[model samples]
Target chain A: MKNFEQRLQRLEYLADRIKEPDLPIEEAMKVFEEGMTLSKGLRKELESLQGKVEMITNGPDDQGGPDMVPFQEVKE
Target chain B: MHLKKPHVDAIVIAMGFPAKEKAAADSSPLLTVSELTSLIKGNLEASFPDVTVEGEISNAKLASSGHFYFSLKDENSIIQAVMFKSKLAALGFAPSDGLRVRAHGAISVYAQRGQYQLIVQSLRKAGTGDILAMLEERKRLLASQGYFDAERKKALPRFPGRVAIVTSPTGAAIHDILNVLGRRNSAIDIVILPAPVQGAEAAPAIAKRIEQANRLDIADVIVVCRGGGSLEDLLPFSETVVVKAIAASRIPVISAVGHEIDWALSDFAADLRAPTPSAAAELVAESREVLLRELDQFQAVLESTMRSKLDALGASLEVFSPELVKARFEILSLPIVNRLDDAHEALVNSIKGLLADLDHWIALACSIIETASPQAVLKRGFSIVRRVGKTQAVSASAGQAAASRGGNEIVRSSTGLEPGEHLHISFAEGSALADVREVNE
Candidate 1:
């Protein structure tokens, strides 16, 4: 998640840089390509995200850490 | 004690039973206190086996054994009531002094005290009005401590990697949250920290689960939620423990208790108050479609900006291209080229005039030379003569003969000429040999 946010920030920055009036064409093109790649990767990641549901067990493990297991909804 | 005797008779009369008449005392056998008390206890227990009484509670106390002891009172009367630990545990809200409640229980006589009391099996707030007033007082107290201060609230993470929900495992809230979160963003991992969402035990259990979620530190945010319920059913969410737990959480909390109209103290203490469990999930998880759309917008902006930049660059390049440069260069160098062309024409004309003058001079010189040259004179029928015989010296022939052949010299005059000397003569077209008879100077 942190990486995703960072990537998004970087992409936005690139987009902003590309819009700078005085930027050289070569530099602008480089930034534009980077922005395009970052956006593509972010889109793919968002599309591929799979959700998972789990429940914390009633008691902690021997190490006093939480134990999680897939949650099954009991149907009435 | 005398006042209670008539009240006891009134209660027995209300139950459609005749009281033991003190007037029949002379004819009847004297009854012991235990016997009489046992009889009253049996009668009371049987008559009011299952009853619900609405009154204000006073002197409420929870014992160490978890029994709740209180008195239910109306404007004119009061009755002692005790809810054992088991039944007390099932209460939706805490029983407190000054709180009005409807107590459901059986009435039994305490023989030791020679009085009858209610054994409450369950309890609920008498009405919403008193509960709201109590809630208002609690809210003020908690507010004074800054439990609902905005400054203390932490901002929720934009993209939560994991969300731990503190709610009932079996409640509709859990299902709604899961459905909404899953539909919006499947990437978020959910961890259910199960707790009873109602009853007297709910408050502590919820607080404990929230604390436990913090201890685990596995989720980016904690969502405390429950489906809509009656005011009493949602009382636990307004409990001090639950509100304090939400305020104390290190992780940001989102409170989504009951429906949109239901407001719990937890909502105030939490970082964000969602109208419903589904809304809480929506707040915590970013929708994939919305994110993708935003990305698309960024991409479009990037593409369009780059296109225009390239187009502008291309336009500038066209200005510098050969054709355009040539056109501009022509405009700049036109005068210089015209001046060079004029200079070249003038130079060619002057050289031609100089060559003509030289040609004229050469022709004139040729005519002058023709007038003075020996060859030109010879062409005019002049003849010259030279001696062909041997002659060693002939100074007199200097002007007459230009060349000597063999031993012969030309005789300018007849001086030094011998009678036997042969002479060679030449005219413009012919030459002849002859003997000279005379040489006169």
Candidate 2:
């Protein structure tokens, strides 16, 4: 799936181009509506993130040795 | 306290350079003890002047006056050295026992103590071949291969949706990177490729992670980081494997190792070098945060832009309305209306002038009428005459005056009336019948 960054970049680009001084008010309104819609949708998607930090585990011989190392914060 | 030995007083005058028994008084040109001491001091100073000697230091101490006193010695020989406060302050590194260094100064004698010493001017580390040089050499060798070339450095994506952190799982670097990523934006997918960042395995492990991230295409960028440590601990970051791995990464690699002073070879090879692990996380996450901020700004711009457009439309709409046309018509007609008022006032004044002229003409006409009217003659006792029954034009011939239709007409001339003809005569006050009029002739 195309990531949110690309979508967000496209939305930002449309928003920028819509601000041209010479653009007709009618056309500007149309673009503004699209940008606002995209922003709302993208923000909603970002807020509803479901994935957490998933440790990749190997199957079969799940010895669980030092294969996948869990992150630790060294205070130094 | 160690006891001072008395063997020095026991003599050695026989063993001294003079050899008193062999040299007769006239043959040796007998010299005083002070003269002998001065001669020895001058010869020693001249012979060993401006010499550079390398030795390990011992009994190093700094006095209250900031002078450094130490003994420079090797296995067999020992020399007392003193560096005054000025030169000691200029020494970049600290001095202590067991540190080997080269001391450069003139060998001079302290006449008061009667002891010879090295007045050390400058001291430097005796580093003919050490880690500092080894590291530099490795860096130079790698750099020659364009491993650290600016052209080889890849530009990081402006908004990386996926990131892989290549660092010790047991290190603060991973936590810092994840914390920064989560705080700025959790939308990015983080793949923590755990690896050692210290010890012998650190270099190879870090290299493996970078290769894995590239092969799997698991991330848009890779971050290699470790906490601050001594040069010995951070050595892995400078290893050829780590440096070469960073240089060969398909995805941009960011190296953040140790504190401000610690620069790993990986730093030079990576796309960007951050001074600290936390700083590296901040640097990599900065673009996404910037994007978010810019998105908010553009949203505001979009709103304001739409609002202004609507406002402008409303303003332009008002221009074409009936009320505006009416208002404009009133404004446009103002000067014409004012001009007409002025003209009306001028017309009234001119009419008044014409009326005044008419009043003068009327007086003249009234005087002429007064002169022609018979009322003035009547007042002067004059009488008017008319034919009794003529209303038609008065007969010019006197003979036809009797044949006229019956209407009163005045006899205009005396020739129209005979002396015996009946005629109506009227004074200004009354009428009478009588008429004897004779032609004046």
Candidate 3:
């Protein structure tokens, strides 16, 4: 989410800039294309992000806590 | 070590109190009051040099010498005890009436007062004290150290990529948090860092887990939480070590220690505080739907804004004439025409033919419009028919009969018309009157 949040903010800024008036045609095209690319990027990110819960055992030499396991089954 | 009653009796006898030493006054030796008191003190002190006693504190008084004097009593017996200022100060807490305490001291007597007492060497709360006040003092100390400052708190990740929970693995807090996060389908990675949530060792374990989470650097935010419990049970979260650990966390921390009414020190020190574990989970990880909605908004805003920009850019060009653009193309083609002399002539002839074709289409459009024009139709011998004055409109068989009786009505058909009915006939040039002589049906 940290990455997602920062990228979303940047995308919003670019989208706003694309609507800036008096922009040269060439420059507007560049900004517009960038916005479209970012829009696709966000969608791709959304498609890939499925909620996952993992647990790490706290022990010495834990290898950066990467011994990840899903959280216990969710109760109703 | 505990001495049996008979063994204590043996020590007392050795200290010069014989079991059957009573004799006639005339034969018995006389002893001074101080001597008897010293003898009793020695016997008692030697028998119980160090003993631990538990009883409710009564008549508690702090003397001018900074000594704490109190009477500890059970249902049957009471013992006066005094703790020197050194031991009292080391307690780091005040003792008051009605508090049960465990006092450790030696049993002796004051020779001057000729009374027995216990010399208190150390004191501890046996069962209960003002827990709230103690918690407040600790809270104040930590607050002064700026551990609970709003500035020290980190902004929770609006979209947390990973969440770490520092709590007992089996406690209801974990289950509650899991339920909430699960219900929302938070598209975030979660790691449960197991820690004790209650009891004497809970504080240290909780603080240690927070440190581990930080050292691991795996979570974007941390939720330190537990389910509802008694104030005493929640004491660990209020411990200074736990509060400081939450403050020092490199990742954002959300503390949810107990039910809504409980406000632990950890809550104050955390980046965010929720009343319950479930609420903390909800606060830390936004739902997948919410993220999708935000993404959708950005895309929608981008599309609509792009459309409007394009529309504005095309506004000026919308009025340009197509024929003028083609003429400009012809002018620009001259250099190519000059490069190929023979082809230039043929090109000119083809362009001429294209112009002729365009002229023919233009003429055809004009003639089509003229044919549909009312005035042009009229010039070609067409006229309009309309009823004038009082007349019958031959729209229907019944309408003819009804108009013939005496009513003036519009006539579209000559159903039941009598000869010599007046009409208004209009051509493109002028209008005139006419009579219907025959019926056409």
Candidate 4:
């Protein structure tokens, strides 16, 4: 998600730069291409629908990572 | 001392009338005032050893010793109560005047004041009104400490990787949060810090779990949540421990306690307050659809910006096309070209006029030359005369004929001729060679 946000921000910046009246054509073209690439990548990521629903039931690992497992709903 | 019966009887008979008769009539022993008071105190203490009394508190004061002295009163009756400093320190809420409470204590007699009062060991707000008052007091205190200051509130992470929920494992709050999160964004890692959402142990357990979550430093945000319940059921959320924990947390806290209408102190102290547990989950992670929409909008904007830039470039390229440039150049240079043409025409006309003037002058010069010509003068019957010698030497020379042909000098007047000088005269049609026979002046 953080990566996505950063990419989106970069895309926005590129878009803004492309709008500059005096920007060199070569630089504008490069920025526009980069913006397109980031936009496509973000869109693909959003479309992939990749995620996990994990629950941390124990303390963090020695490396300070969560000890997570797939969450199972307990029905009452 | 051994003759006490006779002496006492004698003293009593002297001091009061019918002492024996009164004692016999009452069928009881006579007791002093201090002894009777002590007997009553023992009886009262024994009767109400550990009683729980409910009433509104009045005249509540916290003495310098930290003990709380108050009167518990109902509609018609009131009882003096005292909660020692030690017990008062353990209380979750402040005891104040007019707050209804249930106090558990032992009834003891104040022998000095001759009054019976309750020695309270524990105290609790008895109803919603008193609970609200206690919560209000706590809110005021925490507020003064800047616990709920907007400046102190941490902003929630826009995208939280991990979210720790401090809620009951078996309550509806957990299930609702999980469901909402699962539906919206399953990417978030959930840590369930299970604690009782109700009852006496709930507040501390919740606070401990919040602290543990912070200690671990794993979650980007913490959510303290509970499902809808009555005010009494939601009291734990309003507890000072829980509120303080929420206030002091480094990680941003989202409080979603009870229903939308139920307000808890945790709600005020937390960085954000959600109306429901599900709402908190939603706040933690944006839905995939929403993110997709945002991405699409961004892409559209980026593409449009690039397209407009390309269009502008195309427009400039069109403006600079070769044919268009030539046409514009011509248009821009039209006045200068016209001026040059006019200048060229004027120059040609002036030159022609100058040549014509030169032609007239040449004609006048040619006529003057024809009139001044020697042939024309000769044709007018005039004769040319010349002396065939050097003026510096008057004598005839041997090369005279040669000098006559090559170096003859013309005489402007007869007086200029010398006597005996050889002369050559030429008419327009013929020539003559002669000698000056006489002196002429």
Best by DockQ: 1
The residue-level lDDT of candidate 3 at B117 comes to: 84
Off by over 4 Å in 1: A58-65, B1-126, B182-187, B284-286, B364-441
Worst 10 residues of 2 chain A by lDDT: A57-66
For residues A16-59, could you state the per-residue lDDT of candidate 4 as single tens digits? Answer: 78778888878877997888888888777666645555565653
lDDT of 4 at B271: 96
> Which number leads on TM-score?
1
Model 4: lDDT of residue B302: 68
User: What is the TM-score of each predicted model, taking all chains together?
Assistant: 0.60, 0.52, 0.51, 0.59
Fnat: each model in turn = 0.77, 0.31, 0.58, 0.44
Count clashes in each candidate, considering only residues at least 3 apart in sequence or on different chains: 5, 4, 5, 0
Comparing chain B with the reference, what is the TM-score for each candidate?
Answer: 0.54, 0.47, 0.45, 0.58
Q: Ranking by lDDT, best first?
A: 1, 4, 3, 2
- Across B1-441, the per-residue lDDT of candidate 3 in tens digits comes to 244444544544678786576444344445576766677887777888999999988999999999988899999999998888988888845777766788888987888887778898888777535786788889888889899888887887667777888888788898988788778766667788877788998988888888888887878888999987666778899999999889889999999987776678998999889989988887765545576677677777767877777787688776566877787777888777677887878899999999999999999999999888978988899765545443444344334344345444555677666567666555788655677777667
Q: Give stretches of model 4 more than 4 Å off.
A: A1-49, A59-65, B1-140, B168-171, B185-189, B194-205, B228-235, B261-263, B285-335, B390-406, B416-420
Which consecutive 10 residues in model 2 chain B have the weakest lDDT in total?
A: B1-10
Question: How close to the true structure is residue B137 of candidate 4, measured as C-alpha lDDT?
Answer: 93
TM-score of A-chain in each prediction?
0.80, 0.65, 0.70, 0.79
The sequence of per-residue lDDT tens digits that candidate 1 reaches over residues B293-354 is: 88999999899999999999898899999999999999999998999999999999999999
Computed on C-alphas against the true complex, the DockQ of each candidate is 0.49, 0.21, 0.29, 0.32
The lowest-lDDT stretch of 10 consecutive residues in candidate 3 chain B is: B394-403
Q: Just chain B of model 2: what TM-score?
A: 0.47
